[model samples]
Target chain A: MTPAPGDPAPAPGLIPRDSLLPNLEFPFRDLNSRVTPTECFYVRNHFPTPALTAGGWSLTVGGAVLHPLRLGLEELRSLPSRTVTATMECAGNGRTFLSPRPRGVPWELGAVGTARWTGVPLSAVLERAGLPEVVAAWEVVLEGADRGVMTEPVPSPGEISYARSVPLAKALDDVLLAHEMNGEALTPDHGFPVRAVVPGWYGMASVKWLTAVRVVPGPFLGYFQTVDYAYWEEKDGLPPQLRPIGPLQLKAAIARPAPREVVPCGVTYEVTGAAWSGEADVARVEVSVDGGCTWADAEFLDPPMPHVWRRWRFRWQTPEGPGSRTLLARATDTRGRTQPTCHDPARGSYMITHPLPIEVDVRESSP
Target chain B: MTPAPGDPAPAPGLIPRDSLLPNLEFPFRDLNSRVTPTECFYVRNHFPTPALTAGGWSLTVGGAVLHPLRLGLEELRSLPSRTVTATMECAGNGRTFLSPRPRGVPWELGAVGTARWTGVPLSAVLERAGLPEVVAAWEVVLEGADRGVMTEPVPSPGEISYARSVPLAKALDDVLLAHEMNGEALTPDHGFPVRAVVPGWYGMASVKWLTAVRVVPGPFLGYFQTVDYAYWEEKDGLPPQLRPIGPLQLKAAIARPAPREVVPCGVTYEVTGAAWSGEADVARVEVSVDGGCTWADAEFLDPPMPHVWRRWRFRWQTPEGPGSRTLLARATDTRGRTQPTCHDPARGSYMITHPLPIEVDVRESSP
Candidate 1:
């Protein structure tokens, strides 16, 4: 269906993967700042931006709680607020590179961006609703105002709200009910009024267009929870089990010397890129210029942060002869988890953290 | 382009993945014998079957050889011949199951079959061409009469002949230039006159429509050799390298109780399937009836063979309730290599040897 006139439009300079549901990708080649500009941030929408007004909208917290609470935008803003600089990435980023390409948005290494999010701590609101000791083993289900019919992987029953669940511990730890992005009010495309900012997790966990929160006694088996963002877990002496995908894998993507870009030979070129991990701080980044034959360490441009991406740069002395070359970058996390050189099919199309080939041609002389 | 009036037509009951290219998949569900019927064998074609007469066609052997020889079909058949009962499967046999569906023929699970291949051993022909001791470190490239433009992970420069290479050791071992299949002269769709049958490799390595064989001093980097049918190889502290795919991994496929088939509950059902491995003989076959929660050993109907598939069956006692169910099978080879519970993305769309889920439904009563 064509987007309605009131639907949010993607900002210029963003690569559009889909138009109706509006999945925009950040052009990584334009990565020039630590905090992606509001207009430059990638937008991943499961449905058209819901027409929500802050004055009329309310977030309802209920289910398995002693005291159910409903709070409007004004009340939420009045509560204690915190700001976090984090990088959010779609689980399906860099999906196009998968051979025998799996079905999806066909993202190409750009569905990620870093931004400063300002919001009220979810624990404060949950405390107002009175979380009992019994809820420690339960889960907090977050529901979004956005609803749509999912068609890929499997068909859903009618239109379903975008909902996911997090461990009660995680929800009460660092989760945020975000209302401001990069010091500005949240735009409609950015989940106006309020959204969830799930640090250290994939972007999908940060449900956009927040509407409701519920405490459940068991695992949430919603479409997005069990089916879409899930991977097979194989254990010794047991059958492989399907588990929900959680943290991001270590990854580094080259943004400069763009794919197939022509550069002059015999010159020292500065290769720049970004590295991020969901589990720990990025400890090191390496660049391989001659098709993985040799590797050199890159300098990190950003300080080590828990959930923020670190910008990195490397200098390379080009070959004297003109020829084609492939550049690859790999990131290693503080936990010793390094980016895999090959895609893991068990992750399906999600967690595409493999070191990808970025091809470039070196010319004898600059044109 | 539409096939000419005389173009080879797929046999009845064969699943056609591409009508124009004549890529016919075997109906594996009808596998009721040790040897697949000639008409039921799977046919994977890269280009339209070239019209050739046995009297006019000849096989050429040259390149890095002390003596070069060209022989006609009758002369080739005059040499010592051997018969091999082997199972050949397309590397992308189960590609459709890959999430974020990969681009290709979209084959489900039937692009495989077993047949008795009859012809002269490639070693006999190479011996006539006089392979010198220095050729031990070289490769033997096989060229086919079939030619076409390839547009996939990357496009080819122009129309190129279907070609591949094997190590000199392998070419002189069990490779075959076969002119007959299942006790009958090969049909046009099956590469009439001659084709190379590499016993344990994926179907692509068994180049069809044999035309020329060349011994190269080093690695062969043809489009098919390096660009396609290749996977990323990862080693400790080394950059990932692209390597040509060789032998198949262990795989087990359920053929009976077809996917989503309905069966009566509280009844004894015999689940049947086939298992094969390229590296070693299948050591064991296991079936999981409860969504991988438990597994039971299956009874192998065929004896262990080096390059042949073994059929197996499991007796399942259906639950006494009506509901949906999933069936899974896994195979382990003598070399301790077992079918992985998940797809290894490193193999790309090829080597899809994962233990696949076969879903079915259970009814209160037989309908």
Candidate 2:
């Protein structure tokens, strides 16, 4: 069905994991390029898309600031802008693989995509707002225009705006108030008008439908910040403390020879996939055919880039005999972090960066 | 000070993590051969080294068997023997890295060593004991001759033998009762006369100073099995369940260019380490120089083998600038399991297989 005006027109093959909140997953099997097309990029929304226009929208910056500033879309564009090629991944991208199934959107392996974001750095807006009170500021909370009553994790008091907070240091670093995705205006599903694009962090930190930025002196205890998108920080002899999830864990996902795909025996097949991390560039990607018993490095299609996924491919000579084989890919980030084989329960359903197994069948001939 | 008669004469340079229990660590920096020499192998003893001779020692196999047998060392040696080159690592090998420091042996990265073990397979002994009762058998308990009063985790009523249980499937697979290590008689510190060698499992399961083997119809609840060597098995929405630690997790350790050691800048330096896993072969090893920011595959010196560690080396051209740099290595197992970067608290003090960071100073010249 064709989407209505202002509605998200997902790419033809984009798989909708949920319909109401519009959580779409990109078809990774079709992944062949580094930058994902706008329509083909996965869409993750905490609430129904808000019908908003650039002419009426203005980002309000206040709280812990000497000067409160309201900058309209035109004013934001007039300011010096920067474009960053980054990969944004939903925190719960691989939630479907969590045992006992976590209580959240069940994403598989496609809730991640890369794009070129153009916008004024949040630091510029914060600077214009004046930060004489910054000495006491601990975090800058970004509030989205989209609002909804939270159900799971905990019931919120009436309808609340979708919001999250980032540490003051991160806000002034590479955070962007992006109005353009790729080389064009942001689409409705992709946070139209303007959105906060937080590089090297989970997508939740980059709140969509940007509205207000509040710099607070203390930690933000919002529902999304505490009840959801948080992990248990376990210490010896101490109770597991809850901490908000942040950076993306190093991860790799196999794209080609899709799960259970039957391929002809005794032929070389090009296995392709993407590897990414939150804080570090993916240094190496390895492919394993015998269920991880042995691994060979996959050639990177693109040079190492900050805040973006690297495409990698490995050529696998299909076994002479027809049988079932499990294909797996694992990535190690420059910071020496490697994808784990087992899901960490401390992370609950988020940061599913474990090496996922893809079982494929080798047949005498393609079935 | 020289050790007296029947005392453990450790090899020169073996560092003692604990003096009383004689938990010695092999100097990994001196690791240069595939088979670690007898005196150089790390020694782990719970109680005083037992002084026993082969003529006086016997292995008693009982419980849930049609034929309970007591085979002396001579009889055991008369049976068909197999020599396996395997790596035995203490479960708490890297406990020193755990934050807040869990109670146990404070080991660094030296509680592991490889050796050629010559022994009679435990499966052969179990078969001679007759397995008609195997239908109800659940686990095989291996008890050591050494006994000590337990104080940590929980207090024991009196001195008790060090005993641990292995699943029936694993006990019947590759478990060995070895009387020889590196083609020589087992040393007093290395479980004199005889010992159980549970390949592919943590060294704890091997039960040094072996005395008895008991097959039980249910899980064994020995002090070591349940209290000391257990981890919390975390499942969603459930209280963390306590489960005994089992097979070794995939791990790699940087053995050369020792931590904090200074090397001359602007020259080729060989980064060497060893990687191993419990159930699969070490498939790949990658070395990271920039605190894990980027990685290059290390060349494996040894061919892939079952139940053994693979030594790997990567030649790195030292940067011209003199500064402190962190070196790290990560390994992936054949089963697609890669070493985790962070320690999981759920594992407590056991399975410390995360990539350990080795900070080395690149100086103008060697001091």
Q: Give the number of the best model, judged by DockQ.
A: 1
Best by TM-score: 1
Angstrom error of the Cα, residue B124, model 1: value is 0.9
Off by over 4 Å in 1: A1-367, B1-12, B134-136
Candidate 1 interface RMS = 19.3
Docking quality (DockQ) for each candidate: 0.01, 0.01
User: TM-scores of the models, in the given order?
Assistant: 0.51, 0.49
lDDT of 2: 0.81
lDDT of every model, 2 decimals = 0.82, 0.81
lDDT of 1 at A203: 94
Give one digit per residue, the lDDT tens place, for model 1 in A70-142: 9999999999899998899999999988899877887887899999999999999999998778544488888
